[model samples]
Target: MTEPVRRRGRPPRAQQDAGPGMRERILDVAREEFAERGYDKASVRGIAKAAGVDPALVHHYFGTKEQVFAASIEMVLAPALEAPAALVDGPLDGAGERMTRFFFGVWDAPATRAPLLAIVRSALNNEVAAGVFRGLVASQLLARIAQRLDLPEGEAELRASLAAAQLVGTAMLRYVIKVEPLASADLEWVIARIAPVVQVHLTGP
Candidate 1:
């Protein structure tokens, strides 16, 4: 009797079944793969193996490796993507504080921060990853928040981008670079100072 032909780089038969949340499962593994191996080295087969499914499954869910990487980017930025809600949730009087607080809230939590750090590292290291990160930040997160700002056509985007820059720069200094004073400072203390600036960006004439 002939033995079953095992395709090269495929996971075991027992691992072939894609159960519930398989797409998310694949993405989680893809993040780790990209985080560790980087964009150039990470492959569909490797992600699938780590995900306990076939390589075809990763392609099935995300289309291509780049697409998978984009999806992973979206996953890490999901919380920040929801910032528009914070804008609309209450009076514009407190929008800056609300937005600033919300931004750090996402970063302060360990669950989201780890993947975020991986993504930021990848973005800084690879142009492809950086492009994907930039596109998503502009289109999905910034554009949405800009619309909520209720400013004139071009100005809204400017305000949104500036506010985002402030938030992102602070995060980079505090979390990524671990710069002294800022890194060790209290979260509320940081937010107290930043929220006003964000409010100005969004609402000041």
Candidate 2:
């Protein structure tokens, strides 16, 4: 042996020109891919190949396909952080009703509805997406609202969850499912009818 080849740490040729926002690009591509293909059939390698980056980068940013699904979801779902407080605070006498109306109003605009419907459809069809959906709804909307209401013995969670089912189901039928009158109706008209029901869900014993 004349000499031992020494390997020094250096950038690999594959990773040399990885562009900025590469991870985000992969996620964006993956989101569409997952939406189109659903979770089971969507492939990480295919997403990376389309994204023009190494597969490692995908794992680096998102860890796994499941994690990628979670990342994809953050784009769609709005966490109900400020809304609950805004709904409860002393702006109006019918706090519960106002809260309900405000909550529904959040998804009324296209900006809110677009990502939401995409994610909902994906989750409805895929278990991985469903888990992600469940997690986001629980953490952001349900738990926070429960805390705000000062619910006792976790009863508030059931109340909030039932309310969520109603609201989510309505969104599904009207927006995603595109069921007749509910979908065709004007926004305020829809809000007027739904607000009281949601108010009862919030304040009911």
Candidate 3:
């Protein structure tokens, strides 16, 4: 029998043990790794070790540390990225309230908030993490919502950015900084106060 030749970069499958859940496990561990170490210190080897997989598998799945960090950011932001759906499914009349309520609802949920806190902390301090975070938020989340709005070419983006600023600033105080009154206030209470402003940003002149 002739000998089989292996590809240059690919590790042997036996060594990879890349079962169905392996990729997700690596990502979950990577999130915690980046959260703990920040972007500069987190490494493929460290992430692989944490996930009990080979470093090659991490590279194979995510390409590099930056890519891994980007994936982690997307995972945390997945909930928020669905904002356009709320805009599309309902009348534009209450779109601002829907958007506001949806944004906080994701933050208020315990399941999404934990990983979100980790990614947000990393983005706050690391330039690389922050860059990736900003790029994804603009392209994936805000751009989609902007497209859903009826506006002139450049104006939709501006409106969406304004609304995003409003929501993001409020979230920073309420969730990240835990400012006393705002952070402790009821979710609906915050929504009632903020949604009107967001509506003005989105649909007002």
TM-score of each: 0.87, 0.81, 0.90
lDDT of 3 by residue, 1-205 (tens): 9868867656568756667787888889998998788777889999989888778778888897989999888777876786566664687778789888888888899988878888788888888888998999899878877887899859999998999899989988989999999999999899999999999988898
Greater lDDT among 1 and 3 belongs to: 1
* Global Cα lDDT for candidate 1: 0.86
Which candidate number has the best lDDT? 1
Write the number of the candidate with greater lDDT, choosing between 2 and 3.
3
lDDT of 1 at 24: 87
Q: How much lDDT does each candidate structure score?
A: 0.86, 0.71, 0.85
- Residue by residue across 76-188, what tens digits does model 2's lDDT show? 55444446656666533375567657656766776667666667877888887799889977887677666655567478788777777777788778888889999889878
Ranked candidates, highest lDDT first: 1, 3, 2
What ordering of candidates by TM-score runs from best to worst? 3, 1, 2
Candidate 3 local Cα displacement, residue 200, angstroms = 0.4
Which digits, one per residue and each the tens of the lDDT, describe model 1 over residues 1-205? 9979877655456555656688888998999999888888899989988977778777767887879999998988876786666665688778788888888988999999988988888888889889999999998878877777676889999998999999999999999999999999999999999999998998998
Model 2 segments more than 4 A misplaced: 1-20, 78-103
| Worst ten in a row by lDDT for model 1 | 9-18
